[model samples]
Target: MSAWDRTTSREQVLTRIRKLAEIGKISDTGVSRLAMTPLDRQAVELARQWMKEAGMSVRLDAAGNLIGRLESPVAPDAPVLMLGSHLDTQPYAGRFDGIIGVLGAIEAVHAFVSEGLVPQRPIEVVAFSDEEGCRFNKGIFGSRAMVGRLEEGELERVDGDGITRSEALSIFGGDSARLDEAKYAKGSIAAYLELHIEQGPVLESLDAACGLVTGISGPLWLTVELHGFAGHAGSVPMSMRRDALAGAARIIAGLQDLVRAEAGTPAVGTAGTLQLFPGSRNIIPERVQFTIDLRDMDMERRNRLEAKLRELIDEVAADNGLTYSIREDTNSPPRYCDPELMDVIRLEANGMGLQLPELMSGPFHDALALSYACPYAMIFVRSKDGISHNPQEYSSADDIAEGVELLYRTMRSLALSIQGERSGGKWESTTA
Candidate 1:
């Protein structure tokens, strides 16, 4: 039997997930482990213990990222192959969103040790911090810091309770002032791999056990303001009134129409937050502000959609007699999966007799941030009903096991290939 087959059992994996889920258990049904919270710290401590038990050296980075390192006996200074995912959870998030990836990685390393196999490159599993952004309203804090992309001003960002990110980092045992120490130099990491739930319905709808991510969609956030003259609701004639809310509504409708037209494509748009000035029933809305979140896997298509939305907004403002302003808050470009890493996943799935479908992730992940520093790839298990970010999010144990097995196989293959490249020998797939 293969080392993958000899890894931890499905029940063991589920048990670990359950233990982590209990850390921030908000109710009978959900978890609330926001980053830098007491529960978040507890979860990290537990992960540190697990990593130690797996025979790896573990430490917390300056950004509070939990990193477990297993050095290769032959080549201790080789570029590390990194694995794992975020440990933070959304508000009332389900148990499996980020938990599975971290635990699965620990299990993979344990399997490797159990088989007494040593590769040429070190393996590092990192459970990144603040991925949900529920507390500070900014995501990928740890990964961004690791790549040296974190802005200094971001450390001063205050949460709902007025705790600055730096303060929270200090409480969580991280030195925000020393985040530069967390940055990994170029060529320090060979690649990054993560196994997470699909968080969507595509794989479940097709009854597939796993998916190979093609790319991660990047989100473009826009804050739009429409201004018009406030009029008395009872005295103003419908034709004479310049209603900002009405103009905002038209623009939102247009956005929906445009997104619908591009439904089968990678484009998606959402107007999740809106506010009207003087929110009174009898007052005409003089100003309206709304947030638009648009995402796409292709940067060209995403930019085109942005242009089309701007054009539609201009038309809506002109037709409604309202002056409009748009401010782009964020524009994150899409991260395509590394082709060679993707092929390794595909070949491993085929070797294991598992059906792995290719799918683009609509939701962003830590892997997207890691892509800036190294070649990154992800594997996704099917989520039940494609639900995520909710207490109802779920994936079956059988499917989770399949994903973990695939992850182990992929890591094993990468290790062998790294060793082969170092020794000037052809790499052979262990799965074959």
Candidate 2:
């Protein structure tokens, strides 16, 4: 049997993720498991038990991340290695996104336990909270809090139906005290590793099993409100009207044009929402509000795009003689994982006979927030058709196991390097 086969079976990883999906499962091509909901609570509980079964003691921190720790043969706070991903999903999320990371971490621990394989450093597995941000109005809510990025009173942010943060978190444990306990002490972490599905078609299309990401994009969410007159739709002359909707319409069109011009290929913009004040059948929309999401992995490019988008909003708003103001819903700085760490992951994959693709991630992830706190890197298993945030998202059993095997090797390598067990600077040689 191969090293991968010896530690964890391909079928076992798939079975775990598929089974996690089946519980509180939905098939609308959308995953309805929101944060702290009954489904969400159940899934975390299930994985927590699995972590325990893998011979690691488990606990939930103030950030709601599930932590499983293995004692190092060395000592207390011995340089630690962290692995795992988020457990939350989109309103309609697929099976693998975050769950795969959690389960793979479990398997890695199981591998370590079964073989009595103790690297010089201790390893920890964590399942992050609210990574998908499908519920409670904030994605990565759980992670932001851990790194101390989430400010005081910010937890009061509201959701679509006016649901407050307190109300949302209440479903999980209803204790603010517990929430504070979830935070990671600054400087306590040695390094962080997250294994997640590619959530895109790149690896599958390339016939590769894993992607070594160099960077994860930062996200800028903008809300534009256009002010104008709401008059009778029928009697209003097109020439005399200052339609907020019309102004909003031009801005919307401009958004697409701007997105095309600026983001031509990998750059992306989404206007996922629009609202009118009265929303009446005959009322000329006097007020129109819309949302735009802009993302770029390159910080310079991301900043440029944000500045240009703001400039366009001003220009577009002015052309229609409409007053407009933009409210920033969220802004997460772009994250570039340590290239030194990325090279290690790639080397492990190549050593395991898997071709690794260098890629950039478009989605905003909890990893970015954690990156601010420590050295972070990720392994992406392929998703079918580049699909994510929906039920159609998928990764084959074989692909997931390959990603896990790669993570296992990398973790072992990092552990050795941290403990001074490995002599050379890095793992550069590969047999394959």
Q: Which of the numbered candidates is closest to the native, going by highest lDDT?
A: 1
**lDDT tens per residue, model 2, 223-310:** 9898877889899888777678877777677767766886434667788899988888898888889999887766677677678778
TM-score of each: 0.95, 0.86
Residue 195, model 2, lDDT: 88
**lDDT tens per residue, model 1, 1-432:** 465653345767888898998998987668989999889999999999999998899999999999999998878898899998988899878999988999999998888888888866899999998988878888989988998888758999999899999999999999988998999999898899999999999998888989999999888999999999888999999989889999999889989998898877878899999999988999999999999999999889888888999999999889888998999999988889998889889988998899988999988888988899988899999999999999999999899999998898888888766535544533354343
**Model 1, runs deviating above 4 Å:** 419-432
For candidate 1, the TM-score is 0.95
The regions of model 2 sitting more than 4 angstroms off are 6-8, 27-32, 154-175, 178-180, 231-238, 263-265, 277-284, 419-432
